[model samples]
Target: MAQIGLFSSAFFTLLAIIFCFIFRRQAWIALLCSSLLTLGLFMPVSFGVLLVGTTITYFLGNKSQNSSKIGVGIGILLGALVSYKLREIWMDSRSLSLDDFWNEDKPWQIIGLSFFVFNAISYLMDIKRGYIKSTDSIFKLAAYLLYFPTLYAGPLHRFNYLNEQFDQAKITKKSFNNGMRLILWGLFKNFVVAQRLNQLQIELRQSDIGGWWTLLIGFIFFFYLYFSFSSFVDFFQGVSEIFNVRLKDNFHKRVYLSRNRHEFWRGWHITLNEWFRDYFFYWQMKFKFWRDKPYILLLLTYLLIGIWHGITVKFFIWGFLNACWILLEKRWKIPERMEKNNSYKFLEIGYHLLICSLLALVFIFPSLEGLFIRIGKPNFLPMDVFLFQKRNVVIILAMCFMVDQYHRWSKDLRMDAYFESLPSWKRRLLYLPLILSIIFFGVFMKGMDNYYLKF
Candidate 1:
């Protein structure tokens, strides 16, 4: 039954692609309409909310003056977002069991509401700021808001960027090939690597292991989060590419290899960080008071970012600690001072990586006490058991590390150009192993839900 369902889905998807290709000149319209239908089918309530929100934003942008309209639009979007988050908090508080405390399956919860609301608010702000003209056409506004590739977990692309791309959208042979490559790469990362890491993490947490062994779980979790989120972005970006629409890049290739918190954030979730910087951080800094006290503004920005993830105490602490680390880095000028010394540079990289991985424990464990108990207890599991259980995971991690190193070395050139420079036989050989790994080791039946999807 599952295979039949899967086959039917693939068949319809293929038909949709063919239809889009046939009407290539009006590809955006076809994509937008199909995306609306799909979203409506799976998440009807979310679809309704998005439709009404987009309509309200459209009218506000069109009918009112730039200044007051922007404020009103933002207020409406923020009000909706805040209300939804508050409801989530209230529901969590009322849960009868610990297992239900952080339940993701609440009937009232709206998936992707946070992302779309942020995008809609940005759209309004950009109009007032003259970054892009307000569209008179509601369909264009709908297209921007309902674009499926970014509708769920987004890169939070701007209206101007997407609008400009739509003006010249056309899929080429090269783009098609590149899209396939990205899709295959994403599948390998999500299914073969991230899923395995998630499984290993669950196993370690359930075990009696403690001390340094528990610390390894945190590191595993950081990688799992990275791969899972990045893989989703990659997959959807590839889908957009096939339609000749280029979405913004979310993760930089060397994010994990970052030497400082600023560098890490600049690379990690590139779009979201930039959105906060532009719409929230820089906007606040324009005022004299905030401009004079930049550190406070910075702290507030990070805190808001934390609260953006969840309206919870743990997320707040996560944001506060991250803000402190960045401030410390700025105070010492760590990146600048350490850049000239190779030894110091290596140490800085390791320090930042370790700190980030450790900080990730704030999100992984429900409480600080649980986290401390896992990390502080002296009892240790047998080395053989640990090695035996995680042998596959270690091998996968090594493979990912090697690929990342190659990307680091080739950072000067575009990945597509580098791949094109390779001989056809070598390229085919490279694809062979990636495809084989995804087929044989991929966890398809479980762990498909991405970590970032909840937000």
Candidate 2:
């Protein structure tokens, strides 16, 4: 339950710098130290699940080629997931009807168990497929599972990628500069942009607002999610880059340019979606029945995605609806060509934004009854009402939009390369605004955890 606050981020950043210097040639030692430090920050209960899972996987990985052992590993992993996530349902279905069975105090559930388990499972699968060479070093395996940067919220890295990177990591001038830029940029987005929206979200939750306001709030929540989650990913990537690990870029550069749900999914929460796609979707596709009816795999992929968030009804609904939406998009074969025109592109963007905002309502409302109530009843309220009331939030939203647009534009121009091409003094000067932004706007924003940390 302990969230990664601002102070923790600073501590980790400083520690990463120190680790880079001290364990320059031994990244495994740095990772081990970081894992321990991160464990110390959170409840011991949280680390319990991680420790058990990592231990089990490390052992299972040695004999991963054995089908029975692989089954046992998968079973143990799935059992842990079901016992922890569906504890209430499991209890409810019991004949004894022990209402307090789940109430007994245990170690706090792991904060990033969902993501970490995926990493472990992927590692085992890789080993099973002979994709990962057997290594006797527990530290290397531990580092893969317990890597602190992505521990709180991952664009979960594959074990093979991380392992490969560990062997190749080295501190370099370019990585240092780029990492600094990403860190400052991430700080600004999280603290300045997302924090403001978070305040609005809190207010909206407390208020009795409904109708159009719900949709408005949904849009705010949607953007807030992007800002918060992407910020953490950015920071994580930057930290990893500093260590020369260079984790995969989780978010696509042209996420906003997505014209369809499929493209959107490819960009957003990318690592999680990719994990489901690669493991579940692809595996299911091999079955004769599912091969023709690919939508079944699609639906199940999203369902698991939902369940991965938690066993909540909302998460289930969110996953299922999105699954359906994507299937419909595929069935219709939505034209990528129509989005070529400037006007059409803007229209498409607006349409997608509206759809995303409305769909996001599923996350807010637990049941269909309440969701229906909001949709069935529309207050023909002017946009001015909400805009005027939450003027500060509107301004922040505008700032976010502008920043995102700039990001999109910069990517098209290969801004990173351009920055690197600059002279040394000019490159240092570029850091000034980023540093100032983090210092000024981000200074007062403390203890505001990223939204995905809860998942």
Candidate 3:
């Protein structure tokens, strides 16, 4: 029931691994039971809601042959999702503090409901399209919906992909080694990199630093957001792989190297964007009006994506700005034009980096007014204000950037594969420092919650 990054969740994962090996071909049953038990322990109310939602979705898919009934079912599910969003918006609008109303113990604070609901919707849609059939086995349905590794924030996998692997899933030596390596790398990113950046941001904000420091905070937040998000995916995907359940790769390593907004999105949150593209954008393109006036639909799609993060004005602005930049790039053929002059590569990269860092301000501040106030503030803080030494921060960031570049260069091969190809001495030399950094600098005591957990 504990979140994936927590020690308790790791213990549960270890147990699940042992249980799966003992059961052999029936490993899926052990997986399902462990998943359900974990969910029940962490969030019993949410777990009950998940079961009810999954059961309804399963039956609705079964009865989907009746077109009218299926329409009603789809509407009901959408309505529920909309209602949840509205309730959240209302809570945000209220004068009462969120702590006074919403908490982990509250029934309305359903963790991962947004993600699983989207999965359920996609399941029903896939059934209607005849791409996949609804299973008669409720247990399999439960396993697919409530798979523990992805039950929190997810790579947003499809039912067909996971269901096919469940029965045959088992840990091999290669998988175990790869999974452990991923776990260690993820720990380093989250604890050593992201958390330190978080501390720096907090210190800057408390100091009310402005000018270049505000811009630096924005840059810090961009990397912080990336590491906080991608690390969760890496850690959980590693755990899932140990069970031989391969989840979708969420982040492309080249995301930060992107020269434009469109290219950046293709590399960042790859699964979520693909989900919107497949289920929403393509579905709209079926209409002649949407096809003819595609940009209008594109803008609307992004607005929906923004609201999906949270029904807030700041998010709406963030989505709108992103759509505008993307549209500008497409209409002007910016990236294509820039490609002709190789000398302009740095200019192109800087342009995107600046835009993205500014856009990150929307997420880092609670309100647009607060963001402007900070940017407009005349005073500044000295480098001495950093919790971790500023020089150490720079060194860590540079190291990460260099590693990412290497990953980009070897995009054809997986990181685990590249590691395995190295001699034992080289491998030990590489991972030994990484393990030490995590052990010394990791921020495990504060909390294990990820940035995306709210969504």
Candidate whose lDDT is highest: 3
Candidate 3 lDDT over residue span 1-455, tens digit each: 12333754676587788788788878888788888887787667778888898888877877565355555667777777777767656776786554554554466667778778878878888877778877888888888888877777587878888888797788888888888777776777787777777877777677758865587777778878888888878788778777777788888876776788877898899888988999999989999989999999999888888888777898899889888988999999987887677787778888888888898888668789988988887868656675556755775676577558547655766566667778889888878877887776667755554777767
Best model per TM-score: 3
Residue lDDT tens for model 2, 1-455: 22344556567667766786788887667766866685766546667768878888878777557467876887798788766777545554684232243222434446677777788888777777777765687778888888877776586888878878878776788877777666666777777788777777656655656677678767878878888888788776776677677766677766755767877887888788888877778867888999998877789889988877668677888889888888888777764555445567777777788888888888766466887776666554444445654766555866676576657546643334446666879877766755665566552534544767646
Please give each candidate's TM-score: 0.92, 0.87, 0.92
Clashing pairs in 3: none
Encode model 1's per-residue lDDT on 1-455: one tens digit a residue. 12222232234335447667777787777767766776676557778998999999999987454679779889999999988766546766686443353343444546578778988988998888777778989998888888767876588988878877776666688777776776677777888888888878877888888887676777888888998888878776766776677788888887777888988988898888898999999989889999999999999999999988778788899999999999999998877776666677777788887888788888778778888888898968656545766677675767687568657755854344456567899878777877888878778875344777656
- Tell me which residue pairs clash in candidate 1: none
Clashes of each: 0, 0, 0
Give lDDT: candidate 1, residue 93: 68
Ordering by TM-score: 3, 1, 2
Models, CA RMSD each? 3.0, 4.2, 2.4
- Which lDDT values do the candidates have, in the order given? 0.76, 0.71, 0.77
Candidates 1 and 2, the one with greater lDDT:
1
Which residue ranges in model 3 land beyond 4 Å of their true spot?
Answer: 1-5, 96-107, 211-213, 379-382, 387-395, 405-410
